[model samples]
Target: MLRLASLKFGRLFRYGKLLFAASLLVVMLLNTHSLFSSFQRNELTDRRFLSLNKCPACFGSSWCRKFMNGQLSFEGWGRLRLLDFFNVKNVHFAQYGEPREGSRRVVLKRLGSNHELSELDQRICKRATGRPRCDLVQAMYKTDFARLNGDVRLLTPDVVEGWSDLVHCPSQRLLDRLVRRYAETKDSGSFLLRNLKDTERMQLLLTLAFNPEPLVLQSFPSDEGWPFAKYLGACGRMVAVNYVGEELWSYFNAPWEKRVDLAWQLMEIAEQLTNNDFEFALYLLDVSFDNFAVGPRDGKVIIVDAENVLVADKKN
Candidate 1:
């Protein structure tokens, strides 16, 4: 009887040991897989930056349209995560570019509206392209606000949250000094900014800027057809458009000289807007350093805000 009992006990112990070993093996496999996934995501992120920088045309309408149509990868070709937060912040490509959330592609801007950016971009993209592939969703992207042909990056208007934090609205005295210097200088290229303190400079800009948003307009002849109308009309759905540049704000480490040059351009642009040429040009009322940037050609300035631009007649 004793011998039989021992055999039964031995069998039970052996089975338990085997079950424990199997459980441990499963855990090890799972951990390894998890680590591998993390590594892959990181590697892809680095590769994406390289690919994006190398390809200036990546954000062009054709490319965006292709990507929208599923001919291009939603994850961005060559692991270029056009939708990555860091990439979107730095890409500097699309006319109406958006910043995306890291975990999922949560678009914060598109066409004209920002309230439902994630949904709007998705919807417009679907209408413009088609349904995104199920597999593509898993792929990552690196997107940014770079210039693309005539495409205007629509931004939805939202309240300026940090209004109270802006304790530095320029005083009349500061404005007088800055504007006087700007006006006195015969050459726009001269160091009009030489003597002003940082506060005076920014304050001067604030006074000139009037508001954070630009209420400007561009023309679209009805005879030319509905492309302008359709695009601009779509902008109405958005509350506002972005009127700032990543480089303008120095968020991307743009060179100080480049930044100052751009700033000088802002003051120059203001003077130009009042000239006869601006009589027909779009009145970029909110002419801040952030609202414009150097165009493809040297000394060319591009307007980043896609909406709120007014016609010359409207200003009249």
Candidate 2:
């Protein structure tokens, strides 16, 4: 009886040992799986960052710069629309008369796109139920510059648009004179007015709001052929094109979510612009805006004179 009891106890002990070994092996496998999963996630994040931070210039190539440098400027009503948001729609380019350097002077006036309205269109707009200035042509070309110097009699939309026709379609001599003045003054108040358009302000505001982590994927500017290539964020892209057309839409495969992101970013930038808190605004203006791009990474809708997008505190 004692021998049988001894054998049974030994068997029970052996079985318990086997069970313990199996549990330990399972625990080790689970730990290994968890570790591998964490490693994979980290690797993916690092790759994303690297791509975002890559230099745009390194990728833009020489051909791209050629494409962007020679785009045609807007004309006529298109030019008026371009100047409207900044309240400079009434600005008319006129010649000051015979001068030592040139013949004509560039002046600001109020003008609408439809200044060429047929007599019927003008008559219908006149009868419309708004202020006397509510003519369709007037509404289209009118801008508020009351803050600058109050409305000048010469600032009517009709006058301004008419001026555009003369200025844009100027005789070679007139155009040459205006160009000389612009060259001399560098388009400051003497040439281009100090006023900024609303869209421009909005772009600056968005740039200021951006504060990405110091990861590789954060956007930064690059050294492209143009001077404006250096202000991109890590995820920023630079696309050089001569014309402002639908090409911007082609680059991103038209992702709806991406478009929404771009819009949100622009609004954020605009808010910062109005407030003029420009830690990042200057950089964006110098690169993104000057090239006339709307968003950071290869955006369309470029805003000219972006270098002027400095904070009041930082203005030199």
lDDT of 1 by residue, 53-126 (tens): 22221111112322232221223332333224344323122223224522222111222222333343353335
Best by lDDT: 1
Compute each candidate's TM-score over C-alphas.
Answer: 0.29, 0.19
Q: Candidate 1 vs. truth: CA RMSD?
A: 21.0
Write down the RMSD of all candidates, one decimal each: 21.0, 25.9
Worst 10 residues of 1 by lDDT: 226-235
lDDT per prediction? Answer: 0.32, 0.30
Q: Number of clashing residue pairs in every model?
A: 31, 40
lDDT by residue (216-283, candidate 2, tens digit) is 01111122122122221111112122222232334356578767765565565465544442222222
Residue 247 displacement in candidate 1 (angstroms): 2.6
